[model samples]
Target: MSILDLFKKKPKVNGIIKYLNLEGWWLNELSDEEREIILNIYSPMGSENSIIEGEICSSSQTQLHFFWGLIGWFNKPELRHIAYKLISKAETFIDKSSEPLDVHFFYSTKLEVFYKDRDLRPNGLELAIQSCEQQIANAPAAATAFKQKYDGNLPAHKGYAQLAIILEKQKRYDEAISLCEKAKSQGWAGDWDKRIERCDKRAKA
Candidate 1:
């Protein structure tokens, strides 16, 4: 029986109660079941624009779920591009916001989504490093937000480490060293020291 049919009948009916219990369990257990049902009913894939809009709607809902659950649903390889697009849009909303906390959450969520899928993107590390630099420049307050979200010193240190690596790969030893030193000064742990040592060796070679 259809989910709606179960809900439509009187709650006192035994059959309706059984169906209601099953429907509730199905909805609660499966994340994509509602989407699947809706897609099956509407079949919007036949239209190109409808398909795009449907994907965006689905992604927005999934992102909200992940944000609330801390589930990292966007980490799935098939959904990476969709997640990226949604995050990019969210960044735009963040840029327009005057509230610091709201802006911080937007950027933090965007960064997490980007970081989780970093290995999948062709230039993910470089993009992440550049994104951090841009965020630092545009929203200095976000540093504190990052720290709160990632624990003390982690945000700055992680971003700087990635920047150092990218600069080193580009044969810019001095710049890499500078970022590594900054990360160290910001209380980055032993790994920052290792990065500095590697950069120093590369510079001398």
Candidate 2:
């Protein structure tokens, strides 16, 4: 409460300011200095934007919208790293959001992140799956939304492919094979047959 105490404390940067800056960057607000600061702050959760949920009532949904924007807006192959950082930056906020996590977006986007730059971080895949499961557990209703969406006659169900590949990597062959079979039965296209074949061979060995 003292004048010296006030001077000693740094002015708290507003979360909205950071979010808006990111938004501006998305809109081609290209300032190298500011962009570098934004990237550094987000890359390591060095800012309140990552840790503290802002007063935005729809914080969770807003974050997802922003992430989707980044994913779509940065479609060029060369911008992959920037896209990954923007997506990764949302992880902590996704975890801390009080609202039900957007399960479909969470699963799909993380899967995209996983394959987009597999070795971006040493434990990225594990963390992605852990976050997916945690968010689902925390927000059963939102999880059920995705479940219902992908449940029946889902053609070329990308979700199955993503989740199965993770299980396959973990050497859970039976689960992976079972998932492929389910997807095939549901009329999904793609390499379900090849995936099943691989999993079967692995299980036999």
Candidate 3:
């Protein structure tokens, strides 16, 4: 390639860096200042430390989509894949080096994101169900913060609520109702009765 061509060409970055290189895709049209602000914000998020710290809960949502515009999932379908890749990279290190509570929170937040974008991705809902269910089955306690650290609103069985809500959305009303009932039996701190009642009304109607 000629010297001028080399200079004009964008740098080829791999892994997480490529995903943030909006210059080639989305940011070329944006002003230099606009691009700089976005890059400054997102570049840190893609770093190893920031990614590992991304734990999702109702009180403290995941960091991946702190910039809501970044997730424009339906408009920019590629963004979700970028998110999935980042999450996958973190998963490789979760069991290897992360605390059990951190791993638990990661899965919880992933479950929320997958289900939230169920319409965009073919396996979104399925993955969401599995994420919450896996946490509920294996490490139900880890998702909780009993010390009132980040709001102990739904300790020990938040996954149950998440999974049941997804099931409810899918119109599997009976399954949703049953799951809520189970949470009620376990003494979870959620409006389980309300959930069951809503599902029952929907199922009957």
Give the candidate number with the greatest TM-score: 3
For model 1, how does the per-residue alpha-carbon lDDT over 1-205 read when each residue is reduced to its tens digit? 8988877743221222132233343244334643343323333233443211322322222222222222234545655554565455344434443344445344445556666656777977656766656443434455555566665554343345455666888889888888767656655443767767887898899
Between candidates 1 and 2, the TM-score winner: 1
List runs of model 3 lying over 4 Å from the truth. 1-39, 43-78, 96-98, 143-158
- Report lDDT per candidate: 0.49, 0.56, 0.56
Q: Write the per-residue lDDT of candidate 3 for residues 1-205, one digit (tens) a residue.
A: 7889757855333333233332243324445554444444454433452211333233332222332323222223434555554455445444444454665656665665677777767887778778788666645355333334566454646578788877887899998988887777655678888888888999999
Best by lDDT: 3
Off by over 4 Å in 1: 1-71, 96-126, 135-156, 188-190
Cα RMSD for predicted model 3:
9.1
Per-residue error (Å), model 2, residue 75: 5.1
CA displacement after TM-score superposition, residue 188 of candidate 2 (Å): 9.0
TM-score of each: 0.48, 0.46, 0.53
Give residue 80's lDDT in candidate 1 (0 to 100).
57
Show the lowest summed lDDT stretch of 10 residues, model 1: 50-59
